[model samples]
Structures are given as structure tokens and as C-alpha cells.
Target: MRYIISYVSTVNPNISNSDMTALMDYVRLNNNAIGLMGILIYSEGNFFQILEGEEQTVKMMFEKIRKDYRHHNIIKMLDKEIISSSFSESRSSFTVISDHYNQSELHQFLKKEEEHNPEHYKSISYLAQKFMKFN
Candidate 1:
């Protein structure tokens, strides 16, 4: 069955974009080897992400992402099978440039982000970058 996985996390303030890029590069490489469905990431005071894929693929990918140091306090939002993946394929990712949310919307999104126990937003963000580059 298909599933949607949303996550949130905290990153060290000193993290640089180049470093982040390299880290995401690794995630994209690994996700390609595995079966990463769709990915989206957003950040403001903290980081957030959403991933959609098969059960096994999503679970396996989340497991691997937890070991990475780029993020801490990762949490998931939605983790159930939906009618379809939000992505065109099982290996696509996208960046959410507009993460600005109203207070209520932010609260709702965070509630969802906290419930599903996703990996890290950085991983998802990196995946989006790679996906966009390749796609």
C-alpha cells in the first residue's frame, strides 16, 4: 500500500548550505538505491518535511535517515496509505519555498508533523534537491 510520511527536526545553527548540499547528495544517492517516493521540505524556526511511498520503502528510508547527524528530534506527520502518492513517481522530491502558514495552519501542520514520526526534514529537503536535479 502507499503511504505519506511527514517529518520535522532541528539542525545546528552553524550548518552551511554547501555542507547541507553534500549531506543531501548522500541521501539522494541512497534513496535512489532504495525506493524513495515523493519528498517535500520546509523550514522557518524549525525544519519540516513530507514523504510519500510504499510501506516498506518509507519505513526503510526513515530508518536510515535517523542515523544521520544533519537533524535531531525527527518526527512524522502522516504515515498511512493514501489513494495515491503526491509525486509523479516513487523517486521524486520537491522543495516548499513557501512555508509561511497562518497560526492555525501552522498548528495543524505541526500536529500532523509530530504524529507520524518521520525521519528528518533535512533528509527530505536533500531528497527534493536531488529529485529536482535529476527530474
Candidate 2:
């Protein structure tokens, strides 16, 4: 069965864009190796991420993420087994969203960014707004 894990966390204020880019680059690579798929967003010192894959792999990844020092105060929002990955149909198996924008700007940004996938735009924007406590 497939599994999913989603969470929100506070980013370390000291993290620079280059640092995050490197980190996400590694994450994206590792995710592909492990057959993981999902989205990760960092904005205004906050993060919202979703990871889905084999149950064992997803659980193990979350453990590693918990020990990561780049972010803290992780609040897990969703975890469960699913029939399949929700991201399976997405061309970009792993999506990343990050910027210095506020709530309004972020919403506009998501809109413009996902113009190719309205289905993703809906769910992703809703979750992002909710995680930022702006919705």
C-alpha cells in the first residue's frame, strides 16, 4: 500500500536561499531514489511538506526528517496509508515552492506557478494557505 506524511515546520531563520536550495536538491534526489513523491514549500520561515511512497520508506524518511536540524517545531498534519500516490498523475513528481512573499503574494504566486495544473493548484493552494494560517 502507498503511504503519505504531511507536516508544517518552522524554518531556521539563519538558513539562506543557497542553503535551502542545496538541501532541497538533496531531498529531491533522495526522494526519487526511494520512489517518493510530494511537495515541499518554504516561505516566510515556515514549511509545509507532503511525502508519499511505500509505507516503510515514507515512515523511515519522516524519522530522518525529524532529526534534521534545518527546521524545528514540526507539526505533523496527515499520515495514513492510501491506495496510491496522489501525485502519480503529476508530471513533476516532486514540486517545490519557496519565496519571501506574504499570504496574498504567495497565493498569487501559486496561481501563476501551477497554471499547468489546476487540480494541483486547488489542493496545494488550500493547504499552503491553511498552513500559513492565512485561510
Root-mean-square deviation (CA) per prediction: 10.7, 4.3
lDDT (tens digit, per residue) of candidate 2 on 8-121: 899888888889888877876878777887778777788889888889999999999899888799999899998745665454356665664334555655665477556557
TM-score of each: 0.55, 0.75
Which one wins on lDDT? Answer: 2
lDDT of 1 by residue, 24-47 (tens): 556546655566654334354355
Against the hidden true structure, what lDDT does model 2 obtain?
0.76
Whole-model lDDT per candidate: 0.54, 0.76
Runs in model 1 lying further than 4 Å from the true structure: 42-45, 90-135
Residue 49 alpha-carbon offset, candidate 2, angstroms = 0.4
How many pairs of residues collide in model 1?
Answer: 6
